[model samples]
Target: MNRKQIAVVTGAHSGLGKEFVKLLTEDGTISEIWAIARNKEKLDQLISEFGNRVRVFSLDLSDRTSFSVIEKLFLEERIHITYLINNAGFAKFCSYDDITVDESLNMIDLNVSAVVALGLICIPYMKKGSHIINIASQASFFPLPYQNIYSSTKAFVSNYTRALNVELKNKGITAIAVCPGWMKTGLFDRGTIGADRATNNFSGMVTPDVVAAKALSDAKKGKDISIYGLPVKLTWLFSKVTPPKLMMRIWLMQQGIKP
Candidate 1:
């Protein structure tokens, strides 16, 4: 019998990560899955629920030292990673005045730096048909008012993923970015800001399961970028025609926040 293809997804404990884990495990295409997250108990529960198909890896994406541990696993394990999904990130909402240097730096560390580092670390181990999917935000298409830092980080992720796709294409490694709009995940509820605002304006929000399914399907098709939801698509289109300053002003006004 042929060995099942291996897939690795970070942030597997909750939100879209959990959905991805569930979908991929049930998909007959995947043979093995490495569910990486910081929560050991949740990982254990996921493994128990999914049975022997899923392997739990206690990973904290923001930790620079964690790469070495992952590296050790890649080298020692005989599995070929068919897919890598960088889905681990946190959301912080604060105006520039209220945002601290440490908070801003942490956002960059987790959302941008760690993602790039993970891609680089996984590249050497990735086989020819391997694919990498980075979970960015629809905020990448426009400037968000209270969520400035998080939005900017996602913008960077989206751009970086596209640029990297070109470089890896010749080698048969596909890199794609998934840009999803406001998702009904615990991210906002557990965030430092924007939870109340998001709840009040939840009409356009998409479920995490929907987003994850679309992302996986897009990645499998080798799509360069996947932007989820109609409102987000319209916002992205508007950003293309509108000037940066004007767009920022309009977005802030819509959010009832000042530019």
Candidate 2:
């Protein structure tokens, strides 16, 4: 007997994760979607809105056992994986030491570790035409002073996803990194300096839905880098030649932090 097809998306409750869920639910080929998030109430809402095809898994991506839960589910159903969106992550503002050790560690665990784990676990279940979309950020192109851990982790994600795309090409699996700019999500406040830097001089801002739409489309096209909006695309290009010292100072000023 053949197993059902499913899409596994972490951070499925809000932001880009939620948008991806909404988009994937429109895909007729996928039989089910294992939506993972810690907030059960939001997950409930997602299921209610998206319908029965969504299987809610209330698991925190920061936990070591989260991946284990998915593995066990795979054993039971032996599902064919279609889309794996590693989108659960967080960012805390301020200098390195000023931020709590636990906060920084949490950022690393969720953004970097969980992405690595989920991609590894789901890739084996995926074959030709499968897509893996990793939500990196425009910050991944350069170091962000006030968001050090978050940006660095995204850097790791960007590099890893690009490399994975190359390695998985022969297998017909497509893996791509999405580096988007300031998205109008609850995670960011328009009044804050952290938010200002994300908007910057280039592209103003975008909604999570827009980012998800472009990223999913790009993943389907087999693009290694998925950058939403021309401003972000230009930022990624400029980052290649921008001097590190100057970039750091510019970021500091934008965040209202003294360099």
How well does candidate 2 score on lDDT at residue 14? 85
Off by over 4 Å in 2: 189-203
Clashing pairs in 2: none
lDDT by residue (tens digit), candidate 1, 1-259? 4444788899888889889889888878677889999999999998888878889989777778888998888777666678888999887766665656876787788889888988998887676878899999887887777677888899999999999999998888999999888887878765656443321333478899999888888877888898778898888898899988898777666666543
Which number leads on lDDT?
2
Give per-residue CA lDDT, model 2, range 1-259, as digits (tens).
Answer: 9878899998899888999999999999999988899989999999899999999999988988878988888888868899999988887655566556887788899999999999888988998999999999998989887677778999999999999999999999999999999887755642124432332332378889989999999998999999988888887888889997888887767655565
How far out, in Å, is residue 230 in model 1?
1.5
Error of 1 at 45 (Å): 1.8
